[model samples]
Target: METTREGAKKIAHDSTVQSLNQLLEKNYDAENGYKNALTETKSAQLKPYFTKQAARRSRNANELYKAIRNLNATPVEKGSAKAAVHRTWLDLKTAVVGKNDESILKECTRGDITAVNEYEKVLNDPEYLLDSKGMIRQQLHNIQISLKTIRKLKDIVD
Candidate 1:
């Protein structure tokens, strides 16, 4: 009968939708469960790294502060700018070395770039007449190249 055929079609459509809904629900549950597991796993993996990194960064910050203070005290002598930039590089290097999340190094390098920019402004100023401005600029370009390399490393690690 036509009524029976229509009823059968209705039932098939309902069955398909219900099946699809069940599949979707299962997928969502699986994703949520996996996300929770991943969070716990990552937390456990990261704790020791976090502890070491904090101590290292603290020491590096102290060194950086001392370098900056020394630079401030010295007369703006020839090659001082280059030396100061080198000191900044050392600070950045110290902070980032052996870090598990290499992105931390990239971020510190980015901050180094900012510090370089600040130093560059001094070199650019008419009154500053920073010694070895060209050398300092070249060193900053070198730092940029290092940052690119570090970024590549971060991509691979991540």
Candidate 2:
């Protein structure tokens, strides 16, 4: 029974680490995506907002890295390849259609939505990790606010 409990704990820890790494990748992607949007968008008014978002995401990524390391797991250093592809697509779309504020905000909103979903998944997972839950929820709330801000900005642009 003791060995079984230990093994179960180990499995939970491993699962939590995996989820954290995935969230870290998401933060990285969001950070880079915001930077890209900052450079490519013609909306001067949104530049500062984009910069803030990039910084926020970078901070989030660092937090996630620390959490994974604390759990004795390797942290993912960069965004996922799928995110890279999405960034590439955004660039191409901007180049082809020209820089539109609505479109840029739309993409940002999408990225935030993805982050929110991932955070929610981890928070609701079966790991029973209360410590991890608080951290994830804090970040999740921030991302939710970001989504709201993006939507309001897009509405203003429209």
Candidate 3:
């Protein structure tokens, strides 16, 4: 008994939910990546920075989760499998070769780039609801700030 317009609306809502979920997953990945960097880095100066970034990513992920729930969608709690593997590799490399702050910063920068790209995709998609754009824009700005910080640190150390 759904009209065509109703079905279209449903599709748009579903797409928005899916995009939000993807963004949430990226936030989870960033959170884990920052945590790995914090634990693996030997630099005292960088450890606190990584810790703060990790906490920020965690907060962002929780915010995304709440947003998705508000849209009546289930939010995934765990990061992607590829993210877990990447973290494991980083940990093993650190254990074998020793901690390098530059390398950690580079990896963190890559994760930030991914996060920014994910946010952009959602923000640019017309299927995404207008009401959600404000949150997405703010989160994107935060990720961009983190990216800039990582790049600056990498430049300083390299």
TM-scores, all candidates, are 0.34, 0.94, 0.94
Best-fitting candidate, scored by lDDT = 2
| Residue 115 lDDT (model 2) | 86
Q: Rate the local accuracy (lDDT) of all candidates.
A: 0.41, 0.88, 0.86
**How would you encode candidate 3's per-residue C-alpha lDDT over 82-158 as one tens digit per residue?**
98897888778877987788888988888888888888988889877887889889989988988888888888788
> Where in model 2 is the C-alpha error above 4 Å?
none
Summarize candidate 1's per-residue lDDT along 31-85 as a digit string, tens digits.
2322322332334544443344334333333433333333343221122343446
**Clashes in predicted model 1:** 0
lDDT of 3 at 43: 84
In the range 48-84, model 2's lDDT, one tens digit per residue, is 9999999999999999999888887899989999988
Give lDDT: candidate 1, residue 19. Answer: 29
Question: Any runs in candidate 1 off by more than 4 Å, and if so which?
Answer: 1-99
Ranking by TM-score: 2, 3, 1
